[model samples]
Target: MVSPDVFYGALTRASGRWPLSAAARELVRSGVPVFPCVPGGKRPLTEHGFHDAATDPDQVEAWWGQHPGANIGVPTGAPSGFVAVDVDVHGPVDGFRGFSRASRAGLAEGWQFLVTTPSGGMHAYYPATPGQEQRSWQAARAGIDFRGDGGYILVPPSEVSTTGAVAGYRLQRFNAGASSVLDSDRLRDFLDPRPAPRPPENPGLQRQADMSRLAVWVAARGEGERNRGLFWAACRLAENGVPASDALDGLSAAASDAGLGEREITATVHSAYRAAHPTREDSASPTVRDSSPAAPDDWFARDPVSRPSSVRGLG
Candidate 1:
């Protein structure tokens, strides 16, 4: 597998009218899934298993003569589902320049919005067929686009709400290996304490997992009640007297007491912190639910906070 750093270098290679999305579109056209490296499922491509999909990372790597593993996203957009759209770049010379170049290029290509990811150095989005796979990729890009495909050249992570049936976007460096080669359970373990130096797209997505954590936290409660609990916790964290950290700690304690634990709280707190102060970069989350096999048992079960009775309870 290529090192993440090397993969990143590939992303930096994208320049001029060849916006990342265009790069990704080209990749998909050639048949390759973009896999962004992130611990856990914070992004779908990172989380998705390839064998089930009849694809393999080794095959992709072998085909590209690239490493067997690298983080990137796959093309979730249905080959047939793409729509025309426009794009706008929001600030600074660096971003605007890249975007403008891509924009002009996209226009030349008959695309309304093709170059975006680099404009923000983070998240980006593209309109395409919607699906969970797409959602995760967009989350990972932090600021890139490609309705779940094209990999890193265009997609980046972002919390920005995408309108339409399309899920989200993601980006890539070169090739992000195939999702089929990874062992689902092994992947979960690798993500349990996902290494840092994480891309802007990582941390924020973990918070999405917290929703599932919240659901599991309020295990004694129904789905609606758990949602209410999460909302209440967010409100508490936002209160004037509460430090965001304190609010999350307090809320996490409550969850722990309810039978959840530290790992859950840790992951959840990171999620909440990110929610309150998102970098334009953070996006994507593991696509699996809390209890799903796709999720690792490491933190949630072994975490000191994972135990409800040992932890503090929330209001």
Candidate 2:
């Protein structure tokens, strides 16, 4: 039931003093629950984070009073009746390009509000349908992510540390007087596109079993080891004739289990596949020979007696 007039009025009134406490107050007055974040950072001042967002004038006043220069955070999804499609420009893939691709594919043709992040990324705001439960998620193999239920986005005029990667958030496209809502279904379809169906299973390939093992191996990798593990696994899968897309699907699941971030996992898996299958015919292919310690004719076999017993354990 929220109207754009309230937001536009607030924006006009707070135009001159951006990133100031008064601007955040004006946003709150528009019925958008807001919370204070640490100046120049996304970290919330409240202990419970976005859950502490409030529209109450007294609470907002107290929060801004405590931290005069705090940044503003608006919870997305049901809390604010909107979902934010976040395009990360700093990620390995070009987010804006991906979004453009989606748009060209007719997946993103709805009216929406747009905010440009300081990092040169973007947030596309869409009105959430009542009773629609959407969760934050990263689009597979893309630099895009969603901030929906249980998520939050920093509003425009909120400053991020210029010294760091992100710059700040700024209003980009705001239809001042119109209350046009974004098409939720279209946005969801764009963000979470279904994978094309694969051909009938081939019994001879033992593809399912191989993929299962690869998933388990990927899931076992620790933080520092995730990239290398996923890359090696992907290469091995490719060597076994598994399609790159299928391998990526399994690898993504495993990477998620290993607590690796979406961006890192996608980049690593893609890099590995690309390495295994050279894009150019003249490009050097990845070496996939078995180099385990147990393999015969290895370094251990070169000088079994002369080499130290402890050194034999090296792979």
Candidate 3:
């Protein structure tokens, strides 16, 4: 068996070329699923997006032939047997600081490949655990995100338009012969670190009650109500000082029980969390509930600002 170190070394060296099309072909040869991205943009040319990623040389050649200047995009997650930790630079939190914190917490130490993005972000590549179906997440408060199942990332040598603030993406670190891949469990732990135990207090009990109420509210939601309900619940959770991971875990399960798909639940909850907690600090919790019965459409049409001050935080 080819050792992991040897495989990573070869993959890293193979990624050094400038021509994206050629690089795409090389990645395909190396067993990494790849597809053509729109020239100077992140959108994939394939109709099915990352689902169309393939290792077939003929298909890759055909894609590049049609769009010679297209950029290279690699699908992450199970398809490529890897996940990417994307540390972005634009948020209030510093990406490097968050990464350093994770490292200090004993995570990401085994990462073997790194890429610098066009927007001054970093992408750390790690091998995916077999049969694991991790999903993309925007850890906005921490300035980091995960690109896994159902997501794609543009690879090095792929340049965005110069009109943008960033120049382009480039390869940074590659252990030419490293024998290990980053542990997905460690990465997940870093991303969703367990909350430290808190002392028993009235506030903690109150928060639990609030969370249960929110979960019940989410569970009561039906078709066309998932997104709005999740957004509202997430906002409430943020107000109650619940951590994002905890809130996502509880609310996602409730959403699933309400017949919402994983994708919808993830997107809705993340968006709501970011909107609710624009800063790292917790917002005031909503105490009043609108008890008036109303049409589902009416409830959905109401602007977030029209809700209680605490709920309006999600706006």
Candidate 4:
């Protein structure tokens, strides 16, 4: 049901001639489903030749409408809202696994269903009440995939929005449709305040933060104090691509924000990098079954795709 090399075929379509990020490469290697994100409003060019942005409503409608054979299942409209959390783990962990697990439980308590991505990350879908879309995305814990009904569950690659478009994760546009989550009332009853378990100590958080500051100081050319942590995270993200610059101490305010010092940030990054080196392979989830092409969605009403409130795929 698939081409000779399903993932490579997908990657070839998504990445084109350009080099892929370590995270992107990881997805292709692992056979995870990946949707190449065209920068917002832009369309594909080279590798773009491989896939049609099935995401575009008109394109999807036209293609599916005519072919009547394509299996591109769109999500149903239901409760709509976004839940983004700025996790302050305060340090690093064996990986983000513990944090993701805890995050899902908290969302469940909030009466939301959960979806876990390949990057050991999770997205929680909550009741789309009145103020759902009004929430701020600053240090956002989640992102926008809103199509209104059933809305969008998978993350689309986006640079304008810093939501779920992380460097290492593959966003699966299920196309199989979504399954409905149970009543929010019962879920809420179970988790009145959505109490979340405390993440274990991440002694390396401060160091990672400092390193973040240094990277910001280097890239953004601002003072390092404000954007230090952001810089650190970005550079760490970059490590998956090309080698990073080491002379962070010499650079004056490139990556971090204004007012931060470099010595501390520089020292911290070095230490954290030493401790938390995630390999390209380390980011993989348990393999997806049935590498075969998915079944036709002709019997559309028969099933839909969604994160059932109680179910989560293993990472």
Question: What are the models' TM-scores?
Answer: 0.22, 0.62, 0.61, 0.25
Candidate 4 residues 253-290, lDDT tens each?
Answer: 54334444566555444433332343433221111122
Better of 1 and 4 by lDDT: 1
- TM-score of model 4 vs. true structure: 0.25
Q: What's the TM for model 3?
A: 0.61
lDDT of each: 0.34, 0.66, 0.66, 0.32
Off by over 4 Å in 2: 163-166, 175-253, 256-315
Question: Would you list the rank order by TM-score, best first?
Answer: 2, 3, 4, 1
Q: What is residue 235's positional error in candidate 4, in angstroms?
A: 26
lDDT of 4: 0.32
TM-score of 1: 0.22
Q: Quick one: best TM-score, which candidate?
A: 2
Prediction RMSDs, each to the true structure: 19.1, 15.7, 13.2, 22.0
Local accuracy of candidate 2 as per-residue lDDT tens digits, 187-284: 54465442222333553344575567668867876554456567767766655556566777888988899888888776776666566556624222
Ranking by lDDT: 2, 3, 1, 4
Clashing pairs in 2: 118-168
Per-residue lDDT for 306 in model 4?
A: 23
Candidate 3 stretches with Cα past 4 Å from truth are 1-17, 162-166, 176-208, 212-315
